[model samples]
Target: MSYPFGCIVVGSGHAGCCAALSAVEAGCQRVLVVEKGPKEWAGGNGYFTAGAHRTVHGGLRDLLPIVQNVTPAAVATIDMEPYSSEAFTTDIMRLGGGKSDPEMVSAVVGGSRDAVKWLAEWVHVPFILSFNRQAYLVNGRQKFWGGMVLSVEGGGKGLIAAHQQALEREGVDVWYETPAVELILEDGHVTGVVVLRNGQRIWLRASAVILACGGFESSPELRAKHLGSDWSRAKVRGTPYNTGDGLLLAQFAGAQLTGDFAHCHSTCWDANAPDDRGDRELSNQFTKSGYPLGLMLNAQGHRFVDEGEDFRNYTYAKFGREILHQPGGYAFQVWDSQTIKWLREEEYGDDVVKKIWANDVAQLADNLISEGLEDREAFINTIAAYNAAVQASQRERREVRWDPAIKDGLSTQSSQQFLALPKSNWALTLEQQPFLAVKVACGITFTFGGLAIDPETAGVISASSGEPIPGLFCAGELTGGIFFGNYPGGSGLTAGAVFGRKAGREAAKLAEDIYN
Candidate 1:
């Protein structure tokens, strides 16, 4: 059966759902969403997140409306810092190495709060303060830091459910297991989509089409081609369905591909994770991000990157690539009793494998050798040197400044004398008993490269003309130029919502003008 529509959105992830809903609201009577995966796996990478969203907010009061957990009593005990548009813009530009499109960055940062508010007010999605990940207790007061303040109730899966509910409420029809194979371009503009649904190919005509499918993070071939030869060794953190379908579809329709092809959003994940894209049960548990509190060593028992280079959020994305580039694509995050509690709750889960523990550092070193630690003495000596530096820093009165809420100056000095890679902050003495080490591998979230689009309208830009295609558009990870080498925490969801809404609305207007 063939059904013509005014607007057709490929991929039912956060971006596609938002686009479909916004298109219906913008007077597109027959807006439809086509997802490659089944209904159970609908949300894409957004489903695997902690659901944190970075936005410009006045403070706790401004967030109270959307955050269900915030109460008057809870507000007084926490320091909810305001994240302004300027700060958001700065973080995006700085983390992206100033390589991101300034106009898209401005649109994302300026519209972040409104996007979150739209999710709550218009889309009816519920959010709450991300207390577990973004806050720390100081003198009996919980202080929120790191610029992230809110998350959907059950995290990313909850967010997808919310979007599904909103789509159902708005009467937006969604076709599961329907993959858009190609875009039908006519007169130099996108006019329809050829989709593979239920073992049959159908050409669905539309006035406008929005490519919100996602990036090429799950494609091993593409990863090896663009993200270096070692990239295929990295674990896929999200949906395997996102294999560059959107990028290929858009490029075939004359869209300009932009952004950093060699870089992607990655993190330290469990080395034992399956080769395919991980599921919801594993969720964010694949991450082992407590390295700032301790240390990360390669297979040789030698540290490779600076573990405490910055807050985990600021550095986790890039460090995973470092791990992948390491010999055998493996690393271990080691911690002691002193910093064990500082680890995220995900680390202790049953899903994590190759967790080694011992009463002291020497036993820990011996146990690690079986797991591919080539040099036992080198590992022990490295720990000893790191401990000595921590003790020296403690003697210098840096102990009083030892606070985890912010970057305390608790760093190492002598470790630099003995080791190539040294801890830069939170260099606590690993002198405590029962040292713990967990196996880690590189987990790629999404690629930072895709089709370029206009920031104002979310319309795909033609490579030849350098102008927007009449009815072609994109959002989410499919639209590049907003992120490059690195990404700010929680900005992915915000970008999807902001640009998704814009693409949907613009596509609807185009459909009304051209097809009506």
Candidate 2:
């Protein structure tokens, strides 16, 4: 039986889910959610996320005062204190290399606190509380990525399930295992969707359509064609379902696209190689031995950017650069037995950090030699020189670490903490045995660039004239330029939620007001 709906939301990920929820809440009587995968594989980027959700006001607004009082020296304080909105904005702009749009950034920053509060109060999600009895904010003031997940209890699964239940409660129809093959357009407005269900093409009618499909990290051709060659070389860490189908469909319908040059979390595992099992084995090695925990070198044995910066900077640093030119694009973590012991103790309970291998310098060297990933003598010599530099710098009170160039070719902070160790002590030293070197190939989770949209309503805009396409909307990674070059914490999910809600509510209003 064919079905008609007031609105059709493609992709049941965080964006689509939020859009449906908002539509139902806004008094839409008929809404359908079409998801490509089954319930077991429902989550898009929201599932694998580290769960950091940063917002500027509302529940997270209390962090603004703390960030305001922090000095440059205090930025290094690792008490996991809350940060301020101004400081968070500054960091986001810096990370984006000042290419961010002020209006969009301000909108995200301004809406963040309210969004988090809504998620907790209305959505029944439980936010992580701070030691001082407030919601846990990153650096003490801003919301962390995983905060939303903690608020929901069962993490991404819980959040998704809750939304699904809400949709069902509102009588929203959800079609699982139904992938939208194309957008049905009539007279230049989206009329419905042509989906593949049970090996049959089903034409689902809707007054309006919302595209919440994710980015194209899973498609090498899209990456090579849309993004530059450097981004194409990186590995994918997100879901394999994002093959640019929604993007292609929208573009085919004459929708304008933007933000083809943005990406997030460039660090990836060499899971492409048959020899590598996954990130787990490598993580276990890193935790046990404390190796491969410092600055990365290219294949040529020279240090790249500062290893202590966020992984985003590290990923951009390696793009198009010769791995050999920068210390072979992979380097060893040289630490003594004390450091190794400390790391094991510190990271013992954490599953995320347990992937690192902690080993003495010499032992690490031998491990690499045995693995045939490096030459024994050169590896040893490199560690020795690194140790010498670290020692000399410590004595002279000078920064001796190698800092990689980030976007716009600016060097990151020289002194940053990593592996729960001070930057200075984290430097390579030759005195330690079991020196560890793990070959790391640059990896990326997802590309952030996609179609441009109106900041106020999440309506797709014409790339050539910057005008809105009525009756058409986009959310999630499909809507680009929202994050600029770098993303504000939780902007991905937050944008999806905020904009998806707007699109759904607005689309429903437009549908209800349509003249016969």
Candidate 3:
């Protein structure tokens, strides 16, 4: 069947869903969302997300002083800490290596609160306020896809189900398992798409086409081509459907890709294993198990970054960036039993002990030995040395020598707090009964760089001339450099909502102006 849509949105992931919904809401009469996978199947990197959307608005100023004054007492609530807009922007820009587009960054940072409000208030999606009840965090509040499966309820099949329902209500048609193979262009204008479905090729016409199919994380060939040998063998933690289909199609149509050098959650699972469940089990284990945050080390056993820092910040540091270039693109999470126990207890609760393979030092050593991931003697010595420093620091009433990194930054009160904790490096002590070591590899969720677009309209720009590609729009992961290089906590979903709405609304308006 030759299906004609006023606007065709490719890929049914977060960006695609948001784009379609926003397009219909913007008054597009006949909209179509082309999904390459089945409705029940997970699409894009949205499913693997922890669902924390970071914004700088809200009562950030009021909460910053509280966080700064009480962070030591509230370290357990790091996930819930409220950051000011200035702090968030500063950290993001610093993390981006000063390469982020200021205009786009401002839009994303500025629109964050509104996006969160829309998701919570307008979409009726439930979100958890941080442990301190100051900011919002998404933790199992709804299914990964906002609980839209076969029904309108939030607990439905997946996000696509909910997005699809919203689209249908607004008169949008959805073609599942219908992959767009090629773009149909006429007179230097994008007019329609050639889609493959049911073992047959079909033509779907649209006034405008928006490519939101995501990045090339799952495509080894593309990774080799862009990311080089370092990431050639890296495993993916997101959806398998992100094979760069949209990217390839856009490139074929003369679109330029950016941020080929950027990726999300660089340290993930090793995908070389035959039975890789996309690292879901490992991620759950890491999140649920309360492994004390410390520095990661390479096979040669050297500290990379202050593991206590945020994961995203740690990944962009010089050492973490260099580790990605090393063999296996892997590192180890080294911590002691106490931290592990605390983490498991706090994050996973009673289920923490059950999920972890090793409980104490000996069991952990034995477990590492079985996995062939670490040497028992070296691991033991490392812990002993760390513990010795902890004891010495307590007696001396000074910071420990083992961790020079933390000492320089400690204030008087910070030093006192450090001394209070059994004179031990609570964040990185190896003195506990059972030493635990987990083999961690840089698992990239999706590439951050893709075709550049106007931040306001989500219109793809020409690579050579730096002009908008008329009749062509991009959203979600397909639009690169939106976050610059550093990803704000909740910016992924916020970007989808902000830019997706912008793109869809503008695309519909353009379509109506031309074809009405």
Candidate 4:
């Protein structure tokens, strides 16, 4: 421990693990990883994730070899469309509203497939086809929609366990409860880190330091300062350990800030969940994305956004803000028996969230009134009007079917008429018996602002000089400009892998050159 290490990585999340692993792979010896949280709270935002990792692939055939869950027999029963680099790039640009850095987006999109492969093959992250979250059985085949199709086995916990095993195998020493206080710079170059452990300050000298400690989403002060006053009300969907330490470290080192600081990725979390932080046991189960299968109503008994504007993965992030803007900063997702079964059990099962049940529309509204539905009559009228619109649209299409696996064109609008707030697709009547509703609030996942980084080496860019800072690199949520307002689902982890590897490999090369 007395000798100067080759590289030091901050944070112990998936990105940190990837960085440390890559540094070792690039022939760096004695790499150290320092984490802010205790050993029990290891994985940062990654542990709270569903472990879904989006990447470009050539359909089922290309994915079969990497995934462990799908059997040979099951392969024939799967329908997965190939996701090309072009499609991945377009998704990032489109979701980010054309504000994303095209070069950074290219770096991620281009490396996505290789990153996934390395995670599975090298890191031993058990990859699986996301049947529960991303696929639905249609015509006796599991149809994968959206651009997301892969996930780590057993979700986030499994993902972290795999990384831990990999790190141990690579002989990397990870220090838990060692919160990095500041970056140490000498002659305008980052040389090491100052961390506090058990209230004692200690300096660790290394040739290169990589910041992978995530964003400022958990800090309400930072959230309000950047994302506006109302964003403080959004629930912290991941680890409370992030708290902007990486941002501060970079800022103090004169690193340039980039991306939209005012926006973030969020989702519809269960209203009954703890206000300040996410539950470790429930993890991502607190999400209530069933709106795509039914309707989302506010306290005023009115449908707000189009529920089926796109696949759930594409629309879920931005919709959380819409829910937060609703009356009382919450809303309700309602579904009848027909589409109720379509809701992911992990999210809507009785154990996950409170389910209000009623046999008829009026009774349903009456029941929801207790849960903050303001107008029972308006709620009933809304359902009645929605049902009427669906019937009218159905009549216009004749034999149109409801398919959750595709954009089946079963919307609440016909060629000649439309509802004021139309369900774009998967439109179904809410007249079936045993209607159910679940209360939901906004859950802030991660922020989109951090230090601007060099696309190839993941080096933090200097604010004053507009050049890469010597010995300073970054990855994961701590690095910015690949995203702006929003990002495609599963892209977060992929971007982490893409840039984390770059940061680690390049940091090792710098370390070798300096120490030699």
Candidate 5:
């Protein structure tokens, strides 16, 4: 079977939607976006996000265009620090362990603010302050922490909906339940894609093809093959449709794969959450990210990773992998009544959640005795020591004020007194009873590994040859080298918009040059 379009984009997530919309803006009359998932589940992992986009902003004035309901008085009460392009790029390079491609990092970081502006001004995607994840209250005034500030009004679903509306407004054709299976190359250049649509194999010929599909985190076989055998137990946090189709398709096109294949963007999710993606009611509840406010203990009642090493946005992605490495692939996020108000409402209010609480740390340990908890004495002693250390650290730093908006330098000082892993920041005393615990497990978001593409144009480059594949572009999670094991929160959405728009415009130009 055969069909024709001016430009064809694989997948219908944020990347594909942006690619299709931009293609139309670049003079493509007929742009087709193909997705394997059904209409309700078309947006891929992007629809499952918090709608946050990490971008470089020059304080309150720079963010005013996107952030809704921002008054001069409200802005005056908050501290809006500038996140510069250099700082953005440096953060990526640093967090990625210096393995991020400098060129790709530069392109994404340099274009992020403009890309976000485009989304708000041109696409009309409503943006709001990320009060839950990126900001903290200090002195009765809201202060933004981390480099991120804005998110779509309704998060991932809202972001996808806005992009979908824009695509529809541009008259871009969308083919749902059509999964791109193969790339047809002629004279070493991409000409079209072969996809499965309605149980029929159809060859959709186009002047250009943009692969905006995702990575292979959903496939256990691929996870074991690339990310090590331990990833086999990793529960998927998004759609089950992202089974490495895009990565495999790009690889078959001779694209060089890069980034940390053995690592992914993972997080602590409800341990009893479904193996597949959660529904709208669950939303981002699959996440249990407020661990920094309290404690995380393994089955043996021991702290492993540094919960307060940094902000949750900076550390949440990699911590799930650590939880998966623990015995029985489970950990519990423990907190007290005093810090419970700070927990993200999405997580604490989850219907599937089972809260375990007790009056004391020892009683809390006993509550989990039936769930393979062993060391009651150790658990009691650990909390007692942690509490004492917090009191001591507060006294030692008597001149230093405690602030939740930033790293207050208030840490548990007893880690040196014992051999347990230390809480490096925001270590408040867990003495305020009753104690609480929420069982959590590893939930994988997306794989960090993908094909390499041209930094400026988002054109896929051939591995065998050091040249771009003509009429071939790539973006979103399918493009590699920008992220390693760790990524700054909200940057994924920004990357999708920046590179997806670039790929669309470049592919449209290529199509015009060839077929016009």
Candidate 6:
């Protein structure tokens, strides 16, 4: 039998794009990419991301070569700290609660820098230093924080466009509206894929198959089945087409599932966003990440999470569950004029969401009642008590040095006495006039569990024999054992590229070995 293609890639997200290109570079002459969505919905969940990628770097000098937007003057004004491979691994493990696989974490960390460089040079992705999102002008210098400092010029849209251009240049065939229905197995080894195209089931033979489709976050049924019933109601923050096709296909081929199925990468999103789908235009703008700069309170006028706990990306993923667990499945983020101007315009601009403003504490609480504050008295009392605690903490600290780029020791509770829950970082008292607030709800990004794969080759592991399913590779969100309960921000895309590159190169080798 003559095989039509050397390798077939399922899914057309960033991971799949990376895999396809790698396969082509590895000598795969006939490679095809299958995308479940139509041409308009091509990039999968990656289309709705902020396009930030986390990678290890030797400070600014090392990163200057890959980034396209930074100038020499801007570089002198920027003060970025070096992120070591050890630091990256420790951060991932810490955020995952020490449940992340050491091997996978090591692979991602070791490969991240090169993966980012390849994306910038090979794919021509418009890379920029994350000055607006990650840095603050502290002491007349741009200080980048949280160990993440790179993003696409136009976020996900720009990233997808760059990948598309690269694919076109490489002469790869991308079939939109073609969904992979099942894996074609021969003697317990995947040989091809059965796809539904033009309302017909067509079998395409290939030497190797790589699955890079995303997780099951878009499927309410899978969310309820694997992540819990409450997740069924959570708003999807990305493409609605990611219904776990690759995950299901791998399972049907006897792939073993690993990682935490009950958890996901969720965030505080706009409470008013559409429940089932995400806006292609607004995209991640619905995310309410400014909670770290202010206070997040439930309907009953109580602080449920430490808004100042760690950096926003480090804690934002898990905070969505905290908001979902609150009464009525929603919460409100409040900030006074003291911190309102500092909120990121990309997320909290006037046209993005309805912003309620008030002049005083009582008026703010009264206005919030219309927005969902349960008790006016409780809201006022909570603000008063929080203000008092902030004053107390300031007095004990003796010096007030508030820096957004660093864990500015400024806090709301101190030695003499502290609240049951303390704001551990930038804790300016929210007493300034004209307070602002916005309603927020949980926005599910992607699930935490998927098919177990070899960290080196991205080959899916078989459930029956604890061995790789030959010629069946996996990447992206479908490949699990990387993340657990929580994930560090920007790590997902980097991990996807790292493993996708591996899967592509290995699949090309396997195909050459079989067909050449």
lDDT by residue (420-510, candidate 6, tens digit) is: 9889999889988889999999999998899899998899999999999998998888878888888899999999999999999998898
The backbone clash count of each candidate, in order, is: 0, 69, 20, 0, 0, 0
TM-scores for the candidates: 0.97, 0.75, 0.78, 0.98, 0.97, 0.98
The whole-model lDDT of each prediction reads 0.85, 0.56, 0.57, 0.91, 0.85, 0.90
Candidate 2: TM-score?
0.75
Q: Per-residue lDDT tens digits of candidate 2, residues 309-356?
A: 342321232332233123323333334543443333322334333123
Report RMSD (Å) for each prediction in the order shown: 1.7, 7.4, 7.4, 1.2, 1.6, 1.2
> lDDT score, residue 326, model 4?
90
- Give the lDDT ranking, best first: 4, 6, 1, 5, 3, 2
> Candidate 6, after superposition: displacement of residue 286 in Å?
1.1
Better of 3 and 4 by TM-score: 4
TM-score of 5: 0.97
Instruction: Assess candidate 4 and give its TM-score to the true structure.
Output: 0.98
lDDT per residue as tens, model 1, 53-82: 889999888888887887788778988878
* Candidate with more favorable, higher TM-score: 4 or 5: 4
lDDT of 4 by residue, 155-200 (tens): 9989999999999999999999999998899999998999987888
Q: Worst lDDT window (10 residues) for model 2?
A: 404-413
Question: With candidate 5 superimposed using the best TM-score fit, by how many Å does residue 161's alpha carbon deviate from the native?
Answer: 0.9
lDDT of 5: 0.85
Model 3, runs deviating above 4 Å: 60-82, 130-165, 260-264, 268-302, 310-331, 344-363, 391-428, 483-486
Per-residue CA lDDT of candidate 3, range 373-487, in tens? 3556655554455445545445555543333212222211233233222222224446554555556555556677788888778888777768777778898877777544445
